[model samples]
Target: MQIRLQKIIADSGLCSRRKAEELIESGKVKLNGKVVTRLGTKAEETDKIEVNGVLVTQPSKKITIALFKPEGYITSKSDPHHSQTIMDLLPKELSYLKPAGRLDKDSEGLLILSSDGELIQRLTHPSAGHTKTYMVRVKGFPKPQNLAPLSSGKLKLDGYLLNPMEFHILSVKDGKTWIRLRLTEGRNRQIRKVLDSLGYPVIYLKRTEIGKLQLGNMKKGEYKELSEKDISLCFKT
Candidate 1:
């Protein structure tokens, strides 16, 4: 019944599997009183496992949460620079949940956090093809012809070709243009970079949806625990 060390740590709600690997490589994880640093090392459930001197145990209940992340809060559990993190918005009893995906500090919107390692993997993995929707406000207004190339999957940034996306104008007000985009791929700062390249320079950006899970009317910095049915909505292509 031996399981991978990272999986053991992740299932114990200590951290994501990726972060568990980092902890193992940094010699912060030990198996049966001996440091085990190899990525694929395995041990049985009966064996004692420790992470940063902490004994690991599986939680009796698994929890998933949908958080309305506000701008300026880092999406990580901890940062070396001591910046405020999303964890600060949660109660101490729910500290074991890890963010499934990230929203940069400058952007605000729907963010999912979960204690289920498999759910985190499915949501973050590229193969999942989950659609994320964003509401963006940018400077100036551009013609439809100018944005037609974006939906054709011909947009390139940093020498990388992006996937086809759905982009359309939602409104225009006071010298600013509001638009919505649905993207199947999540690239680093892709929306901001794309609009900037198109000469529209984003003024504001917020993600409103992931798959069929909508942000609803949740206020910034508020979070709600998800029921099993609600969690399934995230995978409803």
Candidate 2:
């Protein structure tokens, strides 16, 4: 059977389909020792597939990982500015894996990385509404009325109206407020923007859970491979 080149690379645990497309576009992928930059190309099992001169073989098994990302690391492979990236947090053996979603360089918490692109696609899809929970510390405690917009399902930002999200107050200490929130969409800097718009101004933020996976006891910069059950959970949720 013939499969798309992107699917082949993704199943090989070398990268996600999106990243595979990028590699193809950038002329890093080759077929049968010849560079093939065309998207949607197909390959049979007997055909040779290589990326950057390395053969891409289908994974005999699939694996996913959860990493406790600390602040100050980019979630990318290479940055021209020489900033540290998430790929730096993993061992050399895990370099081919791609992140399922992103946590901005300045925000940190439970982040999922995987070789299974299908699972990554499903988990990262905005329509799935998979819960991504965060612990946010804001600089000042605001009156409850200011938070009504979030609970009311009508907060608009940048001309976009946001759906109601979980915005529970966990505690308020001194002059700051610690809150637990759950969001379905992965808007760019959404949590920070929403809180700042409310005049709270995020002082600290860390994601604790996504779907059934939790940051757990993993310390900063540490990661653990998911069990078979946990991998299944990614699809279920």
Candidate 3:
């Protein structure tokens, strides 16, 4: 069956479809020994494909894992400026897996990494509507009224309007506030910015759940390969 070249690259788990398209446009993708830079080029699965000089083929076994990412570790495969990355916490054999979504270095907890590009697309796509649950601590105690902007879902920061989210106070202690939030959007530094706008800067943040998948008993820096059932949990509302 003929399919778009970028789709083949994505299905092979080398990267996302959007990234694959960029690779193709940049003349980094070759089909059957010929460099093809056209965006809509089609090819059969049997056609040889090379991405950046490496052969692209679907893995015999798709792999996914749930990692309890710790603070201070970058969520990428590598970074020249950073000394630590989430990949350092995994075995070399699992290096092929890419993080489906991001958890900034300052934040910690459940993160999903997968060798299945389709799964990655499903988990990270904004339209998926997957909710991420976080436990947050902020400076100063916040009364219910202070959080009206968040509950109203009208909070805007960095020129982007945030989606509706579930927010509630867990406790107030030692001049700090602890809260739980469930968000459907994954804007960068969103929680921190939102709280900061309300005069409650975040002191700590940890994501404990993605959709129905929970961090459970996993300790920081630990990870477990996900089973089919466990993967299904990630899509559950």
**Top candidate when judged by lDDT against the true structure:** 3
C-alpha lDDT of residue 134 in model 3: 98
Superposing every Cα of model 2 onto the true structure, what RMSD results?
Answer: 4.2
Preferred candidate (lDDT higher): 2 or 3: 3
Total clashes, candidate 1? Answer: 0
What is the lDDT for 42 in model 1?
Answer: 93
Residue-wise C-alpha lDDT for candidate 2, range 16-78, written one tens digit per residue: 689899999999999999999999799988899999999987654567898999999988877
- The global Cα lDDT (0 to 1) of model 1 is 0.88
TM-score rank, highest first? 3, 1, 2
lDDT of 3 by residue, 72-153 (tens): 9988989999669999999998888899989998999999998888899889888888888999999998888888788786
Q: Tell me the lDDT of candidate 3.
A: 0.90
Runs in model 3 lying further than 4 Å from the true structure: 1-7, 14-28, 35-48, 52-57
Clashes of each: 0, 0, 0
TM-score per prediction, in order, is: 0.82, 0.80, 0.86
**Best candidate, TM-score:** 3
TM-score of 1: 0.82
Error at 17, model 2, angstroms: 7.3
- For candidate 3, the 10 contiguous residues with the lowest summed lDDT are 56-65
